[model samples]
Target: MFDRATTFGEALEDPAARSILERYMPGIAASPMATQFRGGRLGQLVALVPALEDLAERERFFAALAEVGDGAPRPPYDPAIAPDPAYEPDDVARGSAPATLPGPTPLWEPLELRFAGPSHGNPFVDVELEAVFTRDSGQVRVGGFYDGDGVYVVRALADTEGPWSFQTRSTARSLDGITGTVEVVAARDGAHGPVQVDGFHFRHADGTRHRPLGTTAYAWTHQPEALQQQTLATLADAPFAKLRMCVFPKSYLYNADEPDDFPFVGSLAEGFDLTRFDPAHFRRLEQRVAELGALGIEADIILFHAYDRWGFADLGPAVDERYLRHVVRRLAGFANVWWSMANEYDLLWSKDIDDWERLAAVVGEEDPFGHLNSIHNCRPVYDYAKPWITHVSIQRVDVYRTAENTDQWREQWGKPVVIDECAYEGDIDQGWGNITGEEMVRRFWEGAVRGGYVGHGETYYPPALGLEGEVLWWSKGGVLHGTSPDRIRFLEQLQSEAPEGVWDPLPSDWDMPWGGAEGQVKVGYFGFNRPRFRNLILDDGGWRIEVIDTWGMTVETLPGVQRGQVRVELPGRQFMALRLTRLED
Candidate 1:
């Protein structure tokens, strides 16, 4: 029997309901398109699936569904968490503090000002709260967000070490006219602030090199507590410095489980309250961001994506604007956060180019720290030439060629090119999720040698391989069962030895992708091609050469220094590279 209010996901759980669905639309259960709507109402699926557009067919399916209905009670919504329309700001405390920011604030660390504001109407809609922090260097105006219960929080940071003063201005009378002073101090050791874009590369606010050796686990935060903890533990030891994760819970293949909490006040069954946020959810997410920061990993937070069972992917322009503003205000304070406007923006059919432009502008404007900003792609690439975009974030358009195009991308944009999603090292049914570990390591080296960075993902689903259920590392973020990560660590070690703390492509033959500071430190990679021996021209004397077996993780130093059209011996095997370090003169 079926519940009239049963969702596409709920129906799948009911044998009779699932059978009814299969009868009406054969193979709909296994359809990738249907899988995306597992959390959506049955009625909503008709609008998305073209086959149900017919009036007769739709009515017939509905009649059949009704015939099996037993009027099962739908899940009840908890009224305690719902916002009260009659609520108002408390009148207990009035007046501004001379120093709202705590004394002796660390540089580049955000300071907070909490205020009680009018809650008669939807503060999220009616209120506009911003604060200006001024110092001898300059001033920065940052937006604030409503954290429910009539509480508004404004956060700002001082880049320079000195005395800084701030004042608040808002639409509500209660929140306005607040003032503060902050005694900014030097940052502790190793606190390199937010990552900023340097021409064709990245460096921290303090000028420390940031090489983005990243990986993808898009919905890790939304997973269960135990799994999330395990993911964090795995990341602590992994070589990746950046994690590309999503703000919203995903609804796709191997990601159909319902999260305990959502960003909004309600659930898919009862309809979410778009105006109010779930504080617990945001708090948990913020905690995760801070945890990743502690582990020296940047959080590349993706705000939107097409994979949705809840209506988050299709939230109207107004809701979208409000949501973006709210998210930026809440997370911008963290130095580790990077604003990825969306992942696979083109695949989100509801948002057009104009919508994306407007949304991106909101993020760029709201973020006071101006962390790295970029949007990813599916098939069509966003124009990285746009002034707001700090760098290029790409998903490979061609199956056969991804990292190979890094040089062209770098030349075209003159910004750091990141091959964020070339492909995964997995054995899944989908082509995007199934590539060999050797191939994955090859892609990383390929991108690195061409002066671009690559990201890694795994999707191994071998039942006999000691995996816990169907938890795939690409989305669920459990134990990593891939061979590329260890190899990637070696690659990171090699790249870290660069004289400039990063590599730049040097002129070389078409067959070999070589990069580093010329006449100083250099690496030449042979991806799949194997040759018996290679000849190289060394400009200066005293160069030490080493043969690197990428897969075997071995580096053997050659006998002595070679110079001027030298013949370098090789193992004549695939996944090999050569490194040359000029001996100190």
Candidate 2:
């Protein structure tokens, strides 16, 4: 609508509306008209008029434009068409008739976007749109032709809701080539402001989902009481079937010989007495185990990284094996306990493995407790002692940095794998590197439950209670100790309610969208651990079957199976599921 300047121009027979326009737009009144309008924060602006209008009115406004600055870059203005007066939602549904409207046809121009701010995380870009109009309706949409990445967020604002739709057109080329379209409906309200919307979606070049392995670590050493309390709270709220507790030998902590320079000491071991085996230590551990049991939590204790100063040298023939026997005998009585032979014996000297094997054999002989036994490998050394070990606890290290290598370890082990310790050095100083709080949660859930590996949760360096310097290793005065209680809750919620049959593989690799084509292979698996379901069923094509044993070994396979695919299904969430195929197959 023209301002009061239109009437004034007509009354005075002034060829232009410059006199009235000058008051509102100051710099444009100059003789040469040096003022210019830019398509900056204010998106492309346009003026519209009914076609039936007289040229006298148009000439007045257009001639007034002559008073504006010359040689200045002025944004191109496109007029928009008015909505069809007869168009109605009900009429369209009935297929009765087509609606018509007045005014010139609307024109759309390519939107130019600029980086307005830094990205929030990896591969996320933030942009700002210029040339926005305050009164007219405008919209913008984005998409990629290739499928590597897609929109992650979108937002819009308006005085009132308006009709609009976003379109994402896919292409076979790189993700960068994708294009987006935004179609805005014609509508207007004098008082209402322009509309804006923001949102995002995930897409892959080949239309396949990018599912990465995730894992977590449970390093609760500094505040035993607080850890136990918080863990109990987490278990009560969410379901966590397995938990790991690191048990350092005496040499690793409270070393009077090197009190000032102990490698990883965090605090003095609570109730640790090297002179004699104390009943209280075991009792405290038992109490903790009982608490875990009350909330359906199971404990996996580390027996390798000794807190004792004697270290591996004391494990030779000179030290009677009876001493080791007594240690396991006293601790094996707990119901919720699983034995982890060593922390990272692969990293330790080969002599450490000898001592571990001897100790493991003795513990197996003496305790005779039907509990499960496994060893946490420092790297991927599951093949070294497979015959003696029940299952291999592969420490899937720094998954954020070395995610690509995970599949290699899983393939070689060919056994049920538990990511015993998964974490990054939080002290690296790059604001937690590429991993984020949300990604951390996703990694653990995807790696263990989705990827079919027994996943453990871990946080970096635990805080030091009063036990600083003498008992614990890697303690930082309570700054980094204890479990992220909220994270546990989130994990439990996600795992406890995962889809049924999620642990089983698809009917066949052929069932996948891109099964055999190059760069088209898709691999995924699902499994869980819970009291409700305990058995694992592995499918060997055409009705063939095999059962996974308690030790996680595929004991037997039906002969003469023709199916190339294997499907494993368990009854409940406590089981792990894995599905793997070549990415480019």
Candidate 3:
């Protein structure tokens, strides 16, 4: 039986009053509030007499509490407990291959547990924890839960100075209880004499887990000869089955004037004459593809943006449909290649076209080989292209300090989606610009894979010779840019290692929960009542679990509840993933 009014008064008296005040009345703290009492008194409440200030504060605070009423249950809170730091990796021998870590098993296996509770007042916070073990060659391999949703594996050189510790934090919800577990195993590797694995498992009554859905690889837009060789070497190290190459003619066209400035060009103008389109560069690129194929990489080429031409205006009516068809035919000959019809057709609207229909029509007719085609849509117009294109590619931008429009795009276009490009602004002081390498990886996985999208698409960290150097209209100018060979290898490995066709269980309708009408399942948060609830049929073994927050940070998980209908809070943007397994008979 908590007293709301008393609790409110006590809360005001506490040292955390400033935070609470900022939360409830952000402007009031900075600007004085004008109040008119029962006697028609007029004054700025925050600036007047001290006695009135105390009285007004008390009254405003209690009035807020009165809305909740006494006996309102306090939300869950879990405190942060430091993880055990005295762990070491199990040693492996000098000549063995890396093995797949065991999957999450039933509670019977020996588990090393680590747990942390919710922060003070936040209803939700992300829960991320990992365990690391050292190998004989001094590399440290890591396995852990990322943001309490996706499980990841990392191979890195270990620090000899100290024992490793695992850390987990909830990105969204304030959890009541926290727990973790780990089990160690010894194995051998060729490069490292001995390798150890600390098997990890994480659980939260309110959290869900998601497995990697698919893999994607990107081609560097431009590079120095030495750097290109280095880039190819890095690509060789990645485990990607599919690779995307930015095969636009614009790279050659833009660099033609400054041939010496071209990073990987043998002879820029010679390789890129529209009338006599050279096959030499394409041949060289093909050779690279063949090299990648030996290492298990499949290639997809950007068929648009040749010589700065994306759509009608850029290519112009003079080029005619015949030339386009010829280009498609030549590209289709490559056994390892697939066609990405356009770099971003949505931007074509500015090129004087009313719609994308004309462009799609031309490619549809010209592509006789049935090359797989997809369109990259500018961030604001992805949904508009859904009906026109075979697949949709989303370009995510930072609108506020947060990832802009992801939840909205997912809600609107429930199709195969890819994040084609993403980045913070050039100014690092802006909260949005401070994204980390780790956060970038996390966002890509969450937005594209776990969010039920098709694949994680990418825009390269522009080089000194490519679009960044010439396309001043959209360049960010090195604020937070550049990708190393190691970065590409990491992405390649992430793509190759992820699972395929992972299920995403977001109900088709956000406002309405699925009710079991014939063969659907009902889903909604507790205490939210609506007549139209349905259940999803698990007849096909294709079901995977995902949770969408109707509101930010607030989710409903009942005690002892294995399965039930529940609604999620959805004010701020957030989502969760749960790995679904078939029930035993």
Candidate 4:
């Protein structure tokens, strides 16, 4: 979705979306509220269309909404009611009076214990609190911090299921020496623990392969409520598995508007208190992170980025560590969180590699879960060789050959490769923000075959929405306009359909070919390369092949041959791929 906050009118920017909304609900697309819900992230505007109540019509509109933005729940097509002005973190529901510990604690889920202390001086600077839990498996100690409004909290994650005892210690009087006990229950369905690197691939702590089919909606959570809802709705339905976004609000290009909240307690005119935090803002982020987890999406949070007018981009090293510590204590407990140290880490003229190293150390020390971590780059890449960096979070070094370098990185870094930013599919004036959908989709295939991951982004400019220059999915969140997301979903489905082995970089005569089981099964994509056909010879013989048109979204299975060589005909077009598997005896 694109940012539609500052550049909205009565009607939705897209004619088709407006038409569908008008036809269904008659006047919703023209209402005063349409100024906001036209992909706004405020309260969700699910207009219940009485006319579209028929199952067929409803399905048609549902598909249309998904195509335009995100699919709605069974709809009357009415606008969703906005929540109260005061926002609280949306958390897991439990059945008790205190709402803190009314039930068995789920494994990998955050368990928070409240502590009250005398706030003598600067509570944020003075208080030091933590909870230690000892189990049959081992002993675990976690550091806690002071929450504003005279509150202090200690949080911990139970890694094992067994009898456990706990103790709390703090510099504050009442908070010190508190003790507790809790039982660790198995994780609920779809909740895999934190992500880890398993050799050349990524997996959950519980051993689930994590295919990071990612997208870069850099400030989706920073937009207004309606737009945020729209972004969530769009993601809830897309096949994307990971979302890369910034914790600090962006202030560049199409992302000039201020975010709804700031992570630190500060304002633009009057500077910020580096030691203190804006609780509501962090709570909102926590809520979004949880929602993403529910949708099977990893929250790849960029803790810092260079784009800023808000001084946040230039926090002193000590203050930066404080911000990192606060974020780790509050946000790292979630199962689907990934720590992206910074976006374009080199572009921040104020900081150096050593500064990033220091922040990474802070996150490393505080995040007990050891979630997947990396630093994205704009120029030279930060050393993934460093033990702290779990995987490679890369922005394209070269426009023409970005994702094709995946296997090379894997070989060089000996870790998982994520081409987090190859480019976007759009007609924008910027080179990075605009490319054909076909090229973007081709990068996805190229990355996948190389045993790595690809990232998605869209920057289609819709001037008709009066945005002439505002709102883009790459920065702000709004309706999806590019053609790459669906095709990438097809690629994901193909990856899931692999039978014998997982995809890997094949050392074949063709540089683009990727396969599983030492080339027993291969998938090759010819990106921007035109060849009518390729002549192939396999030692194993018995080969079944299929042609993949990444843009046309078609898969054509060809006849199998139990021979040494075969002539494969291609459309001689860009974004074309091939799938070959050895027939089993």
The best candidate by TM-score is 1
Mark the regions of model 4 whose C-alpha exceeds 4 Å error after superposition. 1-102, 464-469, 499-501, 510-512
Clashes of each: 0, 80, 64, 21
lDDT of model 3 at position 318 = 28
Candidates' TM-scores?
0.84, 0.40, 0.41, 0.80
- Predicted structure 4: lDDT: 0.74
Off by over 4 Å in 3: 1-225, 239-242, 249-273, 289-298, 306-315, 320-323, 346-350, 354-356, 382-388, 397-414, 424-434, 448-451, 454-500, 507-585
Q: Which model scores highest in lDDT?
A: 1
| Worst window of 10 by summed lDDT in candidate 1 | 77-86
Each candidate: what lDDT? 0.83, 0.35, 0.34, 0.74
Q: What is the per-residue lDDT of model 4 for residues 81-142, given as tens digits with 9 covering 90 to 100?
A: 22122121234121111213425778878777765444545666666667777888777778
Window of ten residues with lowest summed lDDT in model 2: 194-203
Q: To one decimal, what is the Cα RMSD in angstroms of model 2 from the true structure?
A: 35.2
Alpha-carbon error at 469 in model 3, in Å?
Answer: 12
lDDT of 3: 0.34
lDDT of 3 by residue, 1-585 (tens): 212213223433344543444455445433444122111111222222233235456356435444543345644322432222211123422112121333332221112222332222211112222233432334332322211112222212222223223332223222111222222332112111111111111111112122222233322434335545655565555433455555543433123323132212234445422232334444455566556445444455665542332222243432433345434433443333445655554333222132345555666654432334566643334333444454445455544212224445545654444455554322234343344443444444344332323232322334433434422111211111322223333433333332321222344345322211122222222113233323433444333333423222222332332334333222232222222233333
Query: What tens digits encode model 1's per-residue C-alpha lDDT throughout 299-359?
Result: 9999999799897987777778878888998989888888898898766756656788999
Candidate 2 CA-lDDT value: 0.35
